[model samples]
Target: MSNTIYKNGIFGPNEWAVLEDEADLPESGKVLVSPDRFLALEGSAPEGVELGVVIRAGEKAERLVAHLAKLPMVAIDFPKFSDGRGYSSARLLREKFGYKGELRAIGDVLIDQIPFMIRCGIGSFEISHAPTRRALEEDRLNEVPIYLQPVGRDGEVPLGTRPWARRRVA
Candidate 1:
């Protein structure tokens, strides 16, 4: 329900100022991060200021997984939908990084990408414009049912050995 620009836990538009932009930033207990500026930190980011990071196309996704795991939330920036690097980054964050945090998408997000984005690990999405009819349909994506079956041999086992790996050995 919230509509705002974010990175890690910081918020900004095209340009942000350390002192002048206090009004746009969330309160001490809220989180805001800039995907573009996430490479660095600011004056400790209040108390509950969330942080966001931007992943570029073809960049090494593994390098940031460990760093992202430590944070409570992360937002991957998508410069444009045509650029698919963010998709792989999101998948790696969920499958490889084991990041159990709020994974959001910001910048150039549209309706068609919602379902795939959610599967990849983006729980929240920020569309630069007000939700268009197409965008609303994208929100309906939340209603779609997922059909994939239990992936591992625990069949539905809670967690023993990874099913695929065990099958490979068998």
Candidate 2:
């Protein structure tokens, strides 16, 4: 699954040149790759190739905390929409480990899931299906405003400040 649209299509000029398995590393440019490739390179990633990692669904994203400083983007897979583990992984990366990079949700991505993903601190979405692309493009996806609780590491005003919200910062 590929062809990502960041910020629910609200932002642009963020087009990514993602590196897939068995692909050649570009001579110069930011690139996103899989977790195995990042770990395989150790801390010696090729110069000029900005390194990013995509953690598969169900994988332990926390394992990469030590290397967070080296990453500008981290994608957590959602191989199946029913697999909700990526939500936790995303939260841990943002709230606990303090990952400030572009946190992406990839694979099996759907329009309805976008709002929830954002609440979990996912900043981008890798949308491969045409239906998802259409929904997002048309702004038909469900929108959840006035959250009762801020679930991730976002700058939500504290409980007393916002009557309808309570953010638990880890």
Candidate 3:
């Protein structure tokens, strides 16, 4: 059961669909794939597929770095919200691999994690939980505006670090 995606802080529609590792790949639009499923594809796999890869817990980001430019999205699997490995994956994909595309948090995506996930470079989330979906729909998520540690594309300077955090002003 897929719910509306929380994209760019807006509760909006989710056009993408998640498929099993062994399922047949779609020919177009947004499709998220598991790492092993992605690797199993032939080098001659269909082009312009608008692919999004999902990183399971414990999966290394380095293996996906080379494919970053080719993929429009990369989703980190949370499996359980308590597992914070997705945060590391987001940071690596953004900070290290320089992936400017959409970084998504999949699986057990909860409302409370959205703000933190954004800090780690996750641009969107795949929410399936009813309470979570309701929370996002009611605009009850992403309330934190001030942050202590700076990360991701949002250039807000960390808390108490600068008077003019908006920009360099030079």
- Give lDDT for model 2: 0.77
lDDT of all predictions, in order shown? 0.56, 0.77, 0.76
Over the stretch 1-170, how does candidate 1's per-residue lDDT look in tens digits? 33344333333342211222223555544344443344455445656565545455665657665467556656666788798788888888888778787777766887667666765767766656556334453434343233243233222333454445332221
What is the lDDT, from 0 to 100, of the residue 107 in candidate 1?
Answer: 65
Per-residue lDDT of 103-131 in model 2, one digit per residue for the tens? 98878988878888888889888777888
User: For model 3, how many clashes?
Assistant: 0
Candidate 1 Cα outliers beyond 4 Å, as residue runs = 1-50, 131-170
The lDDT of model 3 is 0.76
lDDT of 3 by residue, 60-109 (tens): 98997777778777888999989998889888888888998888888898
| Candidate 3, residue 156: how far the Cα is off, in Å | 4.9
Q: Distance (Å) between predicted and true CA of 134, model 1? A: 6.3
Q: lDDT value for candidate 1? A: 0.56
Worst 10 residues of 2 by lDDT: 161-170
Best of the candidates, TM-score: 3
lDDT of 3 at 15: 73
Superposed Cα RMSD, model 3: 4.2
Candidate 2: pairs in clash: none
